[model samples]
Target: MTGFAQLLDQLPLRFLLASAGCLAAGLGVWGATALLRRLPGVALQRSTWLLGQATVLACFLVILLPHSERLRLVPPIDVADMAPSRAAAPQGPTARPAVGGAPAAAVPGADPASWLTLVAQAWLLAYLLGFGHAVLRLLLARRMLDSLAATGSRLPCPGQPARAPVVIEVDAPISPMLFGLLKPRLLLPQHLRGFDAAQQQLIVEHELMHWRRRDLQWLSVGIVLQTLLWFNPFMRMLRSSLSWAQELGCDRDVLRSRSPAQRKAYAAALVAQLRLQHATPKTALAFGGVCASTLAARIALIREPSPAHPRRARVVRILAIAALACVFAASLAFQPALARRSAPTATQAPFSCTVMVDAASGEQLAREGHCDERVTPASTFNIPVALMGFDSGILKDARAPVLPFKTGYPSYNASWRADTDPSSWLQNSVLWYAQQVTTGLGAARFHEYVQRFDYGNRDVGGDPGKDNGTTQSWVGSSLRISPLEQVSFLRKVANRDLPLSAHAYDMTTRIMPKRTLANGWEVVGKTGTAPGLGRDGNDDATRQYGWYVGWAKKGQRTVVFARLVLDAKQESAMGGARAREAMLRQLTARLDVL
Candidate 1:
């Protein structure tokens, strides 16, 4: 897979898990609100909605936390490697006709890969459509409000400062409402012109309270979140609840200083405004635009308001905030556990293996998939090839003389077209240069060294007349090695256990690709590629196999790892560079070695 595809594979699952956690926390807070319903102070009751909002914010923070740290807590498992034994029978050949032909019937039902691809694409399309629709609706609402403002006339209200909200009188079928985010204006329908001074004061107080609390800004936040998570039902429910809480909180604040008789007058004004218009513009907050149930609740709250102790209310708010903090911490701490359960079964990415070992103790730290399954060494054999060339005095150093390119030889990559030196050969994976080195050493000496290194199946023999058996034997012939053996070989190289001169080892290290991490650690690695079908070296027609083997060092500690992917279609399969990227991603996530 491409690096971008691999990174995208991880996002959806993580987002879903975090969303689930946030929903659960919201429900828990909603349930707690029920017990607080009878509290005398509205501030204490409003704490529940605040807790819900804080919980959602915390969930997002947890989602953004570095996944590597969490993933490292769980050791890798070989779940894919164990799948063959669970199968009902051996599978038939996977090859199919290239042109128009009858499709093959699935063994059980639908094809899982195709189904997953369709589902992912459909979800993304739905999200984009929903978000676009929401944005358009918001724009429409804003236009309606702007149209009303343009036709109305602004008037000055008594006992208010010049910089206070500018009151606008409009001939529209709408209740008294406040519109605009900054420099807000209150829109008063002509129907409200006949109301008494006391009722007008109560209505103005209610709209101003909404402005003081910046309810419009918070409403915009809610709408944006609702648009982004349009597919999540829990988010919809939470947003509705938050809207109700905002209105109710504003109601309590508006009535805080009024007497019981004045509260009754405020309720009457609310009812009178409702009779004129039942609906409010989406971009504006209306004093009497709430539904029947909310209106009744507001009237009841105004009729029998209860006072609460300031100290007690303060304690309750603190406790609620503390509860939200705890939930946030717990979500982050348990993310690995949640991720483990949500992680796709190993069968999804089949035919891959990973092995990591501690360089100091020579102990296996982790293994996943078929780490012990043997495959061709591919271009990875170049490591030993280079070492043998240096030790035998065939090459003096890393900067040894360049090998002249042969025009008659078949070339696949343009980079291999020109003559190259030993360092460039290893860096660019120049196949021809490796073949020349192998041919110069001859099969006899090469076979002797392969046996001494205990490399793979240790079979160096191949077709006798085919380029002296150098290309076939090492690239795609009988020679084979497992990911486990690759790690062992790399460990030996890191420990200087091979029978090579110190200069040869140093020169080889100097030529290895090195990537430095932010933590000051260094990763040295090599990539290898082979044909999916053995005995076919570097043929583009066949599928491909890829390998990445390397060691990481920091201070006195070191780690050796090998990652491999096999038997995949050429276009979809990980190539040599992609294999190295995959290995680096896995290592950075699973270990502290970067």
Candidate 2:
């Protein structure tokens, strides 16, 4: 039971769901094509096939869009929440303590959950490696074609302009193929010179038809999609079907305005090229050399070609469009909604909130809990405080001088044992340091900046006469903000849109910690913790509230997020440390961190 649960937890349910959707789309496309084959003309078959492929691609895209609400369908499971048998849990160390203190608990043995996680990670790595290798192979094939084009001589045909695809006769054993995107060229095998002018024209016409239709560009798109979804066999099958459809479509176009004799000549040319044993580059579109089954289908379709009926073709077009619309709509509508969990138990902490937004577009990617619920900004207020301090010239620089630690202050954290600079103060969450900065800025100036930045509720003046009303209001007193607000503020800071001096903005960013993951992605942010309040408005010593606000950047993509974990029990809380851990776990699970 444990192993099975662990396996289920590690399963890539989302990707599996997408694969199933693609399979359904493929079946629909194949069914439409099967029906088209029974119709009178081959003209509608090409458009039908193209529309089916497009529909499948569109459906796959819809599946990839960010749907935070649907995330409930695969809510993450916290392994720590699971009850473990006493015997399976780690026991106290049997050996005597070393010089530091009592020996730590024995290291826990690997379990089913850990093994399952490792297996999942391995599979992901394999898929990435395969995708990279496939891309490299494509690049190599393009290089090979460039080399062939460079060495081969351009065969001049009368009436064909120089700008037109100059026919290049290469010393390769492969069949004639079309290569290049910007300056397309037709490359013919050396053996092709032995054929009569009529045979050569038939081969050239087919390759030229591919260029007119820009089949190379479409083929490139198909190749890229295949590489991305290499792990999905259905995607591979879809690529194959699309390619076959493309070849058939080109054949239909070539024979569209040709006589019966010309059609027979093109069919003979296709068979003659098939006898060659060489394989063409995957990146290029070849005239012949398709598989035996595809060759057979092409010949059969060519033998009895019928003229397209305008009215009947219009009807088929309408049906194809309708079918595509239905498939796309069903793909989105059928997405499984995430399962909502029941209320938390008494011992468990109340649900928290986390919202991740794209900094550039302000698009919400994923969210959990009630991100809009107002809560005290706690130490997170330090961000705006530092900004205001710099803008007002109250603080010159982040590293100018150090302030002596207030020895008389009562604090639970042991890290605040010595005087610290602005950076150190931010890192250690030294309340005294922030209080000093706020007091220096004073109430009027602070409130002005707060209102300007639209900080939280814009209520810097907390309940009067309270101990925390004046200077400490932004902490755990009265001033409040939500996860969504935090994200917005961070985005403004990142974009330098806030009303602050350039120096102040740079210093604020410099003081904040930036974490780099194994894959070279970076996360820059600050942490804040507030004291939880009881129903009577008194501080609740047993519970704490934590916040982690930051933006993660990889290449050109930047995601700003804010996480708030409330009502955490004392033993399980480390202020912002707890929030950071929770945020990182959720980010890893929801985002493609690897």
Candidate 3:
């Protein structure tokens, strides 16, 4: 859910970028149209159509493309994280701090992330509603056109029998208009039989030209794009302009070789048809995509067609194509905000890692976020300590050698105050018990075992000269492991590949916290959280890192996973528990059976 919320946060920015692209393309088309007014109408028409489609495509491209990571951070959002109670906001592995006093559980409207999420939801709902409404209009319009065509009588082609389209002479008081995309019907008037055969042929020829060029389909594309970018005013204007271009451009094609006398005759047909009204052409309708605004321009252009400037037209065409390429490239170039840190900052960016690997083959199955950046392993190291104890025979089994909590022992969690065996120790994350096991291993064997395990860096030397490697190396001192390394170690444990006694594998696996999924996959994992000096770690939080590592087994299949999250007290919550919940949610979403 949180991951989804982050994506939602980007919706507004995506729309803004797309809108800017539409504005650019619209301006370019306007300039191209003005320059080509003296040339063939087809040039302006085709350019408008092309640039409009490019704008539509840019809208989608912005959404599908990766966002700009170099965007500047929202400063005010990090201001509240300066409170001493929360330490400095997380810098290395940053997280959004639940609005200072707003509380993580019930984040208030004051928080930007919270409100941004709400805005995104509302925007999506509104967009879907608008799109659905547009679609319904198209469907109803198509139905009406079909009903009108049904009542009209079919007629054979006036002149070109072999190449003629299915002509329908409807009784409806409408002008001759081309209709339908897949099944284009050239609808003519029933009274056309009384007019001059040449006039009739001219009308049929005009609508036929639209059918041959598939202009209706292009108009439909424009309508859909207009719907998608309804919020962008420029898109609406571009669509209107493209509609004019479609009609005028078709005029240019139909009269391409006609002399002045023939062009005048065709212009007269358009002027006369302007008197009658037709059900505004909808989806699949041909020349009905034309408008009143273009009728006057069409007649004037047809009566005195421009002396074709082929050379000038070619130059404009090249420039228009170049502008289109620039628009699309600009859209793709913009990236989502959230850059990797290049230098120290007052706060950190959000950080998380979730990785899964095939236990047997050691092949990565799933990976997300930064998994290679190492951090403190914290209490997740308990799994290794448990194995070493069992292997050394110092720990016999899950229930043996029950040890009582000492008065001086660390017991931050109430559950750790009582006696703990291997099972309860893991269940409660009893830190003291792990220290006891390591202490019993006698420094030498402890280092030897960790080195044998090929664990992170294998430093285990504790902090500087503390001489406390066995007791606190994995605590917050020297032992650091990346999420990837954690997965590697876990794969061996799940596959029983480590050079440990049989009892070590069996006892450690038996004691770790286990959850059996519905598909009979037994998942066992451990959670860990650690605090450190905020200064040296380049993080603001004393409690900065969390880990959840484990493996899942079902019959012959086994998969190991490691998840890590970091925050500077983003909330009053245990990091390990948060990491566990998030990791499990991701696993549940991706895994079909296990």
The number of clashing residue pairs in model 3 is 10
Which lDDT tens digits does candidate 2 get at residues 412-449?
Answer: 57767677778887888777777777778776776678
lDDT of 1 at 170: 89
Looking at model 3, the pairs that clash are: 67-335, 67-336, 68-335, 68-336, 90-348, 91-348, 94-349, 94-350, 178-286, 180-284
lDDT, residue 232, candidate 3: 59
Better of 1 and 2 by TM-score: 1
State each model's CA lDDT, in order. 0.66, 0.67, 0.67
Q: Candidate 2 clashing pairs?
A: 72-338, 72-339, 73-338
The Cα error of candidate 3 at residue 143, in Å, is 0.6
| Clashing residue pairs in candidate 1 (N, C-alpha, C atoms within 3 angstroms) | none
**TM-score to native of every candidate shown:** 0.54, 0.52, 0.56
Ranking 2 against 3 by TM-score, winner: 3
- N/CA/C clash count, model 2: 3
* Ranked candidates (TM-score, high to low): 3, 1, 2
